[model samples]
Target: MNNNSNLSSNNNKILNTIDTVMGVKEEKEINQQQEYPPLNGQKLLIYVMGTLAQIGFMTLTLWLINLGFKQLLEYNLDVRINTIIVSLFWIFFTIRSRLFSPLDNTRSRRQYDQVIRPKWAPPAFVFPIVWISIGVLRVVSSYLVWQELNQNFLALPLIIFTIHLALGDTWNTIFTVEGRYGLAVPVVIIGPLLSSFVLAYVYGQILPLAGWLIFPSCIWLMVASVLVINIWQLNQKD
Candidate 1:
């Protein structure tokens, strides 16, 4: 009876100590009120899905533009040269997305005071011109891929990778920014990006010389591995 009582007392003391260290308590003591709920994952996921579908459809329509470009340009340009152009455009797009996306925000309240663009803003009408320039790069990438690859198969891989990118940033940004369990999100996203390059290497650049049909299958296996691992981590709830 005495041992049981002692153990109960010790456990209570430990819990109190932990709670004190963590600063968890009734809300009234806080100097400035921060009315925020815990990150509800289910809600975040629904928003993410909507965003992902938009990105997927946008990418597909963009790809059709590429197909048209390929018919006009012909596949005369070297694949490596095309890849270089795609890389540069991707960099520009990434920068623009970071700069402009209203969905790419954090905090519950609008901190309009913190939002500011760079000093080297072009003329008053520069925004539309800048946007159109980046749009051309995206269309050209689609066209190059369609021209270089005979089948429409290139669209499938591009869609998969873009979905992966869209999901990674959405989940990562939404949760991590809100102090939620966004474990290894960067690693998860980066692993797939690297896999895309590997797939391009094995299938697009090498398989023809190797005289093999297994490259596509192998590339898919890598993608599956990434998805499985990430899903497992998400399910583990940490």
Candidate 2:
């Protein structure tokens, strides 16, 4: 059996949604008091594959942003590099989610939250401070094609989603401490999807593009995110 029972049912309900997305099997314990299964060689392989999938997804995200900047905004070099830097930090932290777990009261964890998250958060915080800054970053970074390429209002959703991704760990810690971390997977995924769609609509108004890609983008993200998580899950057997 696996550690699903260790998670709260509420959290499991959310995790169930991720299970639907990733097709992960329930690792039920033979006895209620039984421990999670020990990891083995086969499961480790599966875990690594899942991790690689996540890495590839982040890389693809980088490429998509690059394509949008060049094709739509006609911006190059510094713009692409800056955008990539932001995305890299975002993806880097996300992939290292375990390392940043709020439960991680380790010295390294403090360093990451204080030193690391701050390093990345500033430029992004400044991202929406100016109209052009908001326009350049949010417009193309978001999937909306219709949003204006140079406007202030577009920062609304972009700002929130960024905060959500960053603060999600804090929320998870709260849930875990409250005896509810089990359902972390689903809530994390769905919350972002909803916020993302809203952000897309906001971006559409400011700098409109094809609205059709919004849902598709969400699905892709779901699949991509699950694929990445599955990697770590596979290692749980170890």
Candidate 3:
């Protein structure tokens, strides 16, 4: 009779332990559900639409400003008026987004010459104009991708371009402004190469025109890489 009683007690304990464990798991699941709602199809669509709209808005604003400048120049508008318009436009965007800073390039060039003047570096005139053209192309490509947000095929290229832009900006700041060439060189090399590869894919698969528009950026990146390589070679002795 005592042996049977002990066996019954052991079974009760095991049952109690399992109940406690299941209760804890249920509580955890409930808490997770309360914390983060499931990202259903509607929520995902809203998120993507919001992102594309923002991109389109910003690019359109900048492109309009460029168009305004061109028209002002064609009609022989006052230089001061034109300057003020461009300056204010840039200042607004710069204040809103550090990524769109107008002063970074000037600062970078000044710092670049101060840190090291590579023999292979392009002329001062070349960089600013090339970057300006690239900026326009960036806006164009972004606008194009924004238009095709629902297509799914353009997604990878836009993602790659975003990373490329971020890396390029970071490389400039660290290498040129902060004078951290060791880290910057890798970013410059890898960022552009990755950008080139994605752009090639984009040209073949998704939007050929947009990809062609981005070709200059890739070419400029190659030239920039050569300059960076030269700087590394020349500065190692320092």
Q: Cα lDDT of all candidates, in order?
A: 0.43, 0.39, 0.54
Instruction: Looking at model 2, report the run of 10 residues with the lowest lDDT sum.
Output: 104-113
Residue pairs in steric clash, candidate 3? none
Off by over 4 Å in 3: 1-106, 150-156
Flag the better candidate by lDDT, 1 or 3.
3
Candidate 2 wrong stretches, greater than 4 Å:
1-139, 143-154, 167-181, 210-216, 221-238
What global local distance difference test value does model 3 have? 0.54
**Positional deviation of 175 in candidate 3, in angstroms?**
1.1
Candidate 3 per-residue lDDT, tens place, 1-238, comes to 9999999999767644543322212233322211223435774354345434444555555556546655677888787776566555433442233234332321224445555666556655355456655766765665465445542322556555544554455455445544545545666787655666576567436667777777877877877887777776667521
lDDT of 1 by residue, 1-238 (tens): 9999999999767655543432223234433433345546775565556555646654764476467546635866776776565555444433233222224423221211122323432332332333344334333443345445553523554455354445434543443233233333443445444544543444344234221232333454355345434543544433
lDDT of 2 by residue, 25-76 (tens): 3335112322333445764354344334443444444446546544644545
Native-to-model Cα distance after best TM-score fit, residue 219 in candidate 3, in Å = 0.9
| Top candidate when judged by TM-score against the true structure | 3
By lDDT: ranked, best first: 3, 1, 2
